[model samples]
Target: MQVNTRSDVGGKAEAMDYTKEAIADPVVERSFRGHKGMVTTAAFSPSMKQLASGAKDGVVMVWNFRPQLRAFRYANSKSSSRSPAGKEAASPVHKVSFSPKGDIVASGGADKAIRLWVPNVVGDCSTLKAHTGAVRDVDFGDGGATLLSASDDKTVKLWDLKKQKFLQTFNGHVNWVRSAKFAPGGAYAASGGDDKTVLVWDMQQKKSVKALKHHTARVNTVAFFPSGNLLAAASDDKSINVWDLRTFELLQHYDVGSVVNEIDVHPTGDFIISAQDDATVKIWDAREGRLFYKLHGHEGKVQTAQFSPHGDFFTTGGGDGQVMVWETKFDRSIASIKKKMAMKEKKAGSNLEEAKPEEVDAKIEEETEAEVEAEVKADAKHEGVGERVQAKKVSISEPAEDAEREVEEAPSSITREPEVNENYTEAAKEEVRPKTAPSASPANPSSSLPSTSVSGEQVMSALGTIVNQMNSLMEVVGRFDMRLETLERRMDALEK
Candidate 1:
């Protein structure tokens, strides 16, 4: 099953921070339209070379990621029940999923059957039939040899694809099961249904282990975070719930205005994408729930949204029968994501030190000098991220000239409150928003993921340097103060 996997750009290099750039004018890079009816689902192959989409017209189409290549589609023939599975659209294909191996594609629809096809080779396919009603969704296991499926028959079924056998029926939902997916580790499975509940199943036992009853309406889809411990469920009730499997804790709950049809966490687990009834696909920061972008291209309601295996691209299926591909620019590939993070760290390091506090020029006066010495000693004695500045004792007999210089500098000591505050605020903002890594700070380089703060090491290092300089000035001040006291004592004794 060989298919063209070429890009239209033809192997040219792009900016390393391509995705970090501001959102493009036209959010959809390419739109693939072949379905006569609404699109139900879209999925990217593990290799990211192909995309498989299912439509309400019953066609399961496989396309090269490039727009130039034609799509290869297979559908069920309605004329004959025994006709070759390589036919035409007979009923709506509600969901399509690519196997982990990227070699096989699974699709389920109103036909009450799930089909596995090697998309590149149209006729080479098999069907697994057990659901008594329409099949709603299908997902591949971690190894791709097993599958989990939800159906209108009010059950989620597990299948052994290698043997083409029905493994077990996970029956807990009292209504139609809409979606089901295997955990990243394959230790558990989750399902959402019209029953208004999300069920977590222990894969080994093939039974529901926990139930989340929060959605006031139907649970449209369920997906597991890459870690396999966090489960996210979208609902017709206009909300998305993320819960931790270990502690059954509600980690995040978002009241999205539109009914969320489906949600997928990025491969990096830093962002989440949602398909909504508002015809908008939203990208969100998984940690903070911050909305990054509300992509608008679909003419009708969006039905399914998924991040590519690499997180560089995402696909959306809409009621307009169009499948849109989005370039996120933020690639989740280990090397690329790591490089992006490294660049962010470097930028933050630069910004944090960009506005360093200049040397604090203090006026030399009796009161001000005393205050300066006391403050310097206090800072020197403290153990902190700042370097331990040590104050040295000066010999009272050392030099009259040095004492005179100390007296001269005393008048220069004035509180630099205004200037210090100016740098403090800028550094503080940079300290809090490291992900913005505003290299204009090129005016604001924000990340789609949760923001990071500047490291304390750099800030402390700067403060340590300032403290060291202040401590040096303190040694001379002590000597000058002793000289004045000695002169006063001699003058008083002579007068007596």
Candidate 2:
């Protein structure tokens, strides 16, 4: 039997007029409605025959898209057994994701727990409780054996699906972690957070390998390209950054004109889609960094958008509590226009002057120097001694003049505390003093005195040296104390 791969849009168009008419009108095949609250997230199953949605009502609904639209509630057996007539989450659900094999689904939310469910099942849901704060997003690894979750607790945790046990916790973001996704092949995972940074974690090493810093506001979402050679980060700064994974360099930057809530890359690796706070979804040509389309239909902010597995359709969920599905139709006219635009850009680039190698190196060096100077100035103005110490540590690799300047501008308290501590001298003297008395001799009358008294000058010199070393050690301890205090405050807040 011959397989039918034709899309819902039919085939290529012959004229631009036909293409324009087709693109202007999008057919909504079906609208699935059951959630009592706003649908915060939605995803298509691996087979594209089902859809899973999560809402603020703390409920997850799975819809069968084939034959007819039927809804199924995913709830824990414990909760169902207690109240069989009711169906609702204990807290708001934030995210829902399907496993690679389509046999399982994971949902996490404000309850600070990840619940696993099998579609069409009424009860017996397994819950994984580890995060201290609201869980923002969850993603399955390539083989579906592991899962990654981002949480407001400022951590991204990895879990083993079979054992249902926590594997590792990635902690570096200073603010809430909003999104996490495993890279292709599952060797690395990328996470974005309210700290305005994107961290790439090495799964095997269990550590963050690279930090991508460009977003000026909270990084709301992150997605890796199909090839995993590039990673995209969307932020509240109204910009999306595409980073080259191999070199850890910024490849392209596209401004979406509003806060981006979520982002997804096309399976074809040719386009990227972003749901914006401005009640619109924007599509961009991923390779060229150019806007491709602006889809507008939602009455409120678009919260999430995703493409289907077959690449024939896409879905968008909004704050208005509506989910709209659109058909993906690539007509000949659209392709021709993109091709011409690419050629035009290539032709125009020859007239531009490109920077030489030396100029590029000089520019990088200048930027580095400016950043260091700004940090030093900021640290000097702040009253926190820990900040100044951190600045000093960062400037250790700078030129002698710069280091000396940092020391001169450092706060008087940090510089004088070591000198005021008399314990260092006393401790050194006590440690160096001998227990036995010296034998008296005719040639050496001074030997009759106690070691502490006879060698007072030597002891004083040793004390001074010990004091200097202790002062250095104290600086390190101060930094550690500052970090410890911050962690204590976080834990206390979580407890409350």
User: For residues 215-280, could you state the per-residue lDDT of candidate 2 as single tens digits?
Assistant: 999999999999999999999999999999999999999977999999999887888889999987
After superposition, candidate 1 runs with Cα above 4 Å error: 1-26, 66-68, 77-89, 330-496
lDDT of 1: 0.74
Per-model root-mean-square deviation over C-alphas: 22.0, 26.4
Model 2, runs deviating above 4 Å: 1-26, 67-69, 75-89, 121-123, 331-496
Question: Tens digit of lDDT per residue, candidate 1, span 366-419?
Answer: 344454456654543462323222223222333557655545665345222334
Provide the lowest-lDDT 10-residue window in model 1: 9-18
Full-model lDDT for every candidate: 0.74, 0.74
